[model samples]
Target: MAEMEAALLEIIKNHAVGLTGPLTRETPVSDLGIDSFAVVEIIYEVEEKLHVEVPFNANENPFGEMKSVGDLIDALQKLAKPA
Candidate 1:
Protein backbone atom coordinates (compact mmCIF):
# COMPACT_ATOMS: atom_id res chain seq x y z
CA MET A 1 0.00 0.00 0.00
CA ALA A 2 2.79 2.37 0.88
CA GLU A 3 4.54 1.52 -2.34
CA MET A 4 1.42 2.23 -4.37
CA GLU A 5 0.88 5.49 -2.54
CA ALA A 6 4.47 6.46 -3.23
CA ALA A 7 4.06 5.52 -6.87
CA LEU A 8 0.98 7.73 -7.11
CA LEU A 9 2.81 10.62 -5.50
CA GLU A 10 5.60 10.20 -8.00
CA ILE A 11 3.12 10.53 -10.84
CA ILE A 12 1.46 13.61 -9.37
CA LYS A 13 4.82 15.10 -8.54
CA ASN A 14 5.63 15.44 -12.22
CA HIS A 15 2.84 18.00 -12.54
CA ALA A 16 4.50 20.47 -10.15
CA VAL A 17 1.86 20.18 -7.45
CA GLY A 18 2.49 19.49 -3.82
CA LEU A 19 0.82 16.57 -2.08
CA THR A 20 -0.81 18.88 0.52
CA GLY A 21 0.36 16.61 3.31
CA PRO A 22 1.69 13.11 2.85
CA LEU A 23 0.28 10.78 0.23
CA THR A 24 -2.52 9.05 2.03
CA ARG A 25 -5.29 6.80 0.80
CA GLU A 26 -7.86 9.48 1.54
CA THR A 27 -6.19 12.30 -0.36
CA PRO A 28 -8.33 13.68 -3.16
CA VAL A 29 -6.89 14.24 -6.63
CA SER A 30 -9.05 17.29 -7.22
CA ASP A 31 -7.57 19.03 -4.21
CA LEU A 32 -4.36 19.24 -6.16
CA GLY A 33 -6.19 21.23 -8.87
CA ILE A 34 -4.74 19.12 -11.66
CA ASP A 35 -6.70 19.51 -14.87
CA SER A 36 -7.98 16.66 -17.03
CA PHE A 37 -5.09 16.58 -19.47
CA ALA A 38 -2.62 16.60 -16.66
CA VAL A 39 -4.54 13.76 -15.03
CA VAL A 40 -4.22 11.61 -18.15
CA GLU A 41 -0.58 12.39 -18.40
CA ILE A 42 -0.14 11.47 -14.79
CA ILE A 43 -1.97 8.20 -15.21
CA TYR A 44 0.00 7.29 -18.29
CA GLU A 45 3.11 8.30 -16.48
CA VAL A 46 2.14 5.92 -13.70
CA GLU A 47 1.56 3.21 -16.25
CA GLU A 48 4.98 3.69 -17.77
CA LYS A 49 6.76 4.28 -14.50
CA LEU A 50 5.32 1.27 -12.70
CA HIS A 51 5.04 -0.68 -15.94
CA VAL A 52 1.37 -1.36 -15.20
CA GLU A 53 -1.30 -0.62 -17.78
CA VAL A 54 -4.37 1.35 -16.65
CA PRO A 55 -7.66 0.36 -18.25
CA PHE A 56 -9.47 3.69 -18.13
CA ASN A 57 -8.22 7.08 -19.21
CA ALA A 58 -7.74 9.58 -16.47
CA ASN A 59 -8.88 12.43 -18.67
CA GLU A 60 -12.36 10.96 -18.65
CA ASN A 61 -12.43 11.73 -15.00
CA PRO A 62 -13.43 15.07 -13.68
CA PHE A 63 -14.83 16.08 -10.29
CA GLY A 64 -12.51 13.54 -8.83
CA GLU A 65 -14.21 10.48 -10.24
CA MET A 66 -11.39 8.33 -9.00
CA LYS A 67 -12.35 9.74 -5.60
CA SER A 68 -9.31 9.31 -3.41
CA VAL A 69 -5.75 8.14 -3.50
CA GLY A 70 -7.06 4.77 -2.34
CA ASP A 71 -8.66 4.29 -5.73
CA LEU A 72 -5.26 4.64 -7.29
CA ILE A 73 -3.91 2.24 -4.74
CA ASP A 74 -6.52 -0.24 -5.90
CA ALA A 75 -5.51 0.36 -9.48
CA LEU A 76 -1.88 -0.43 -8.85
CA GLN A 77 -2.80 -3.39 -6.73
CA LYS A 78 -4.89 -4.86 -9.50
CA LEU A 79 -2.25 -4.25 -12.09
CA ALA A 80 0.71 -5.58 -10.15
CA LYS A 81 -0.93 -8.30 -8.12
CA PRO A 82 -0.97 -11.81 -9.57
CA ALA A 83 -4.19 -13.05 -11.03
Candidate 2:
Protein backbone atom coordinates (compact mmCIF):
# COMPACT_ATOMS: atom_id res chain seq x y z
CA MET A 1 0.00 0.00 0.00
CA ALA A 2 2.85 2.35 0.76
CA GLU A 3 4.40 1.64 -2.59
CA MET A 4 1.09 2.25 -4.29
CA GLU A 5 0.58 5.49 -2.41
CA ALA A 6 4.06 6.71 -3.30
CA ALA A 7 3.50 5.92 -6.95
CA LEU A 8 0.18 7.73 -6.86
CA LEU A 9 1.70 10.80 -5.25
CA GLU A 10 4.43 10.88 -7.85
CA ILE A 11 1.91 10.69 -10.65
CA ILE A 12 -0.22 13.42 -9.09
CA LYS A 13 2.81 15.65 -8.62
CA ASN A 14 3.69 15.27 -12.25
CA HIS A 15 0.21 16.06 -13.52
CA ALA A 16 -1.59 18.28 -10.97
CA VAL A 17 -0.78 21.69 -9.59
CA GLY A 18 -1.43 24.10 -6.70
CA LEU A 19 -0.88 21.51 -4.05
CA THR A 20 -0.90 23.46 -0.81
CA GLY A 21 0.78 20.93 1.45
CA PRO A 22 2.21 17.46 1.57
CA LEU A 23 -0.28 14.96 0.23
CA THR A 24 -1.78 12.47 2.65
CA ARG A 25 -4.17 9.59 2.25
CA GLU A 26 -6.92 11.85 3.49
CA THR A 27 -6.04 14.62 1.07
CA PRO A 28 -8.76 15.23 -1.45
CA VAL A 29 -7.89 15.25 -5.14
CA SER A 30 -10.00 18.34 -5.57
CA ASP A 31 -7.79 20.13 -3.06
CA LEU A 32 -4.84 19.37 -5.30
CA GLY A 33 -6.68 20.95 -8.20
CA ILE A 34 -6.73 17.84 -10.33
CA ASP A 35 -8.98 18.33 -13.30
CA SER A 36 -10.96 15.75 -15.24
CA PHE A 37 -8.36 15.27 -17.97
CA ALA A 38 -5.59 14.92 -15.43
CA VAL A 39 -7.59 12.29 -13.58
CA VAL A 40 -7.88 10.26 -16.79
CA GLU A 41 -4.20 10.68 -17.44
CA ILE A 42 -3.41 9.59 -13.92
CA ILE A 43 -5.59 6.51 -14.31
CA TYR A 44 -3.87 5.58 -17.57
CA GLU A 45 -0.45 6.12 -16.11
CA VAL A 46 -1.29 4.12 -13.00
CA GLU A 47 -2.68 1.24 -15.06
CA GLU A 48 0.37 1.14 -17.30
CA LYS A 49 2.94 1.60 -14.56
CA LEU A 50 1.32 -0.75 -12.08
CA HIS A 51 0.52 -3.29 -14.78
CA VAL A 52 -3.06 -3.61 -13.59
CA GLU A 53 -6.38 -2.94 -15.26
CA VAL A 54 -8.62 -0.49 -13.43
CA PRO A 55 -12.19 -1.68 -13.70
CA PHE A 56 -13.54 1.76 -14.28
CA ASN A 57 -15.91 3.19 -16.83
CA ALA A 58 -14.69 6.38 -18.41
CA ASN A 59 -18.16 7.43 -19.55
CA GLU A 60 -19.58 7.17 -16.04
CA ASN A 61 -18.82 9.36 -13.07
CA PRO A 62 -15.28 8.13 -12.60
CA PHE A 63 -14.59 10.31 -9.60
CA GLY A 64 -18.04 9.96 -8.17
CA GLU A 65 -16.91 7.69 -5.36
CA MET A 66 -13.22 8.46 -5.19
CA LYS A 67 -12.98 11.54 -3.04
CA SER A 68 -9.51 11.12 -1.54
CA VAL A 69 -6.20 9.56 -2.43
CA GLY A 70 -6.84 6.73 0.02
CA ASP A 71 -10.07 5.89 -1.78
CA LEU A 72 -8.21 5.52 -5.04
CA ILE A 73 -5.49 3.49 -3.39
CA ASP A 74 -8.04 1.15 -1.89
CA ALA A 75 -9.71 0.68 -5.26
CA LEU A 76 -6.41 0.04 -6.98
CA GLN A 77 -5.31 -2.42 -4.34
CA LYS A 78 -8.53 -4.34 -4.68
CA LEU A 79 -8.32 -4.47 -8.47
CA ALA A 80 -4.63 -5.24 -8.55
CA LYS A 81 -4.70 -7.97 -5.97
CA PRO A 82 -4.58 -11.50 -7.30
CA ALA A 83 -7.93 -13.15 -7.60
Candidate 3:
Protein backbone atom coordinates (compact mmCIF):
# COMPACT_ATOMS: atom_id res chain seq x y z
CA MET A 1 0.00 0.00 0.00
CA ALA A 2 2.80 2.38 0.89
CA GLU A 3 4.55 1.61 -2.35
CA MET A 4 1.42 2.25 -4.34
CA GLU A 5 0.81 5.46 -2.46
CA ALA A 6 4.33 6.64 -3.14
CA ALA A 7 4.06 5.83 -6.81
CA LEU A 8 0.74 7.59 -7.02
CA LEU A 9 2.20 10.69 -5.38
CA GLU A 10 5.12 10.70 -7.74
CA ILE A 11 2.81 10.48 -10.72
CA ILE A 12 0.68 13.31 -9.40
CA LYS A 13 3.69 15.44 -8.58
CA ASN A 14 4.78 15.24 -12.15
CA HIS A 15 1.50 16.69 -13.33
CA ALA A 16 1.09 19.19 -10.52
CA VAL A 17 1.96 22.35 -12.39
CA GLY A 18 0.73 24.66 -9.67
CA LEU A 19 2.48 22.98 -6.86
CA THR A 20 5.38 24.97 -5.45
CA GLY A 21 6.34 22.64 -2.64
CA PRO A 22 6.77 18.98 -1.95
CA LEU A 23 3.79 16.83 -2.71
CA THR A 24 2.26 14.95 0.16
CA ARG A 25 -0.88 13.04 1.09
CA GLU A 26 -2.28 16.05 2.93
CA THR A 27 -1.82 18.39 -0.01
CA PRO A 28 -5.07 19.78 -1.27
CA VAL A 29 -6.13 18.84 -4.79
CA SER A 30 -6.80 22.48 -5.57
CA ASP A 31 -3.21 23.23 -4.73
CA LEU A 32 -2.09 20.86 -7.44
CA GLY A 33 -3.73 23.01 -10.10
CA ILE A 34 -4.64 20.03 -12.22
CA ASP A 35 -7.34 20.56 -14.78
CA SER A 36 -9.75 17.99 -16.21
CA PHE A 37 -7.36 17.11 -19.00
CA ALA A 38 -4.58 16.59 -16.52
CA VAL A 39 -6.81 14.30 -14.51
CA VAL A 40 -7.26 12.02 -17.50
CA GLU A 41 -3.56 12.01 -18.13
CA ILE A 42 -2.92 11.20 -14.50
CA ILE A 43 -5.26 8.22 -14.65
CA TYR A 44 -3.55 6.99 -17.74
CA GLU A 45 -0.19 7.32 -16.02
CA VAL A 46 -1.50 5.48 -13.02
CA GLU A 47 -2.63 2.61 -15.20
CA GLU A 48 0.66 2.49 -17.05
CA LYS A 49 3.01 2.97 -14.11
CA LEU A 50 1.14 0.88 -11.59
CA HIS A 51 -0.14 -1.67 -14.07
CA VAL A 52 -3.63 -1.45 -12.62
CA GLU A 53 -6.93 -0.75 -14.29
CA VAL A 54 -9.12 2.04 -12.88
CA PRO A 55 -12.67 1.28 -13.90
CA PHE A 56 -14.43 4.58 -14.44
CA ASN A 57 -16.85 6.06 -16.89
CA ALA A 58 -15.56 8.74 -19.20
CA ASN A 59 -18.76 10.75 -18.77
CA GLU A 60 -18.28 11.00 -15.03
CA ASN A 61 -15.73 12.95 -13.09
CA PRO A 62 -12.95 10.66 -11.96
CA PHE A 63 -11.92 12.76 -9.00
CA GLY A 64 -15.38 12.98 -7.62
CA GLU A 65 -15.51 14.74 -4.23
CA MET A 66 -11.79 14.42 -3.82
CA LYS A 67 -10.42 17.23 -1.66
CA SER A 68 -6.89 16.38 -0.66
CA VAL A 69 -4.24 14.22 -2.23
CA GLY A 70 -5.00 11.63 0.41
CA ASP A 71 -8.56 11.41 -0.84
CA LEU A 72 -7.34 10.98 -4.37
CA ILE A 73 -4.96 8.24 -3.34
CA ASP A 74 -7.61 6.43 -1.34
CA ALA A 75 -10.05 6.62 -4.21
CA LEU A 76 -7.54 5.23 -6.66
CA GLN A 77 -6.55 2.44 -4.32
CA LYS A 78 -10.16 1.41 -3.94
CA LEU A 79 -10.94 1.60 -7.64
CA ALA A 80 -7.79 -0.28 -8.57
CA LYS A 81 -8.58 -3.15 -6.28
CA PRO A 82 -9.81 -6.38 -7.89
CA ALA A 83 -13.41 -7.19 -7.24
Which candidate has the top score in lDDT? Answer: 3
Tens-digit per-residue lDDT, 20-57, candidate 3: 99999999999998897888899889998888989888
User: Which residues of candidate 1, in runs, are more than 4 Å off?
Assistant: 16-19, 57-64, 79-83
On TM-score, the candidate that comes out on top is 3
Q: lDDT of candidate 1?
A: 0.64
Return the clash pairs for model 3, or none. Answer: none
Displacement of the residue 25 alpha carbon in candidate 3, Å = 0.8
- How would you encode candidate 1's per-residue C-alpha lDDT over 1-83 as one tens digit per residue? 67767877666756737555665567786666676677667766777777776666346453254777667557555655322
Give the TM-scores of the predictions, in the order they appear.
0.60, 0.76, 0.91
Clashing residue pairs, backbone N/CA/C < 3 A, model 2: none
80 Cα displacement, candidate 2 (Å): 3.5
Write the residue-wise lDDT of candidate 2 on 4-30 in tens digits.
779877877777586878887888868
Clashes of each: 0, 0, 0
What TM-score does prediction 2 earn?
0.76
Model 3 segments beyond 4 Å from truth?
none
- Tell how far residue 76 is off in model 2, in angstroms: 2.6
RMSD of 1: 3.8
lDDT of 3: 0.89
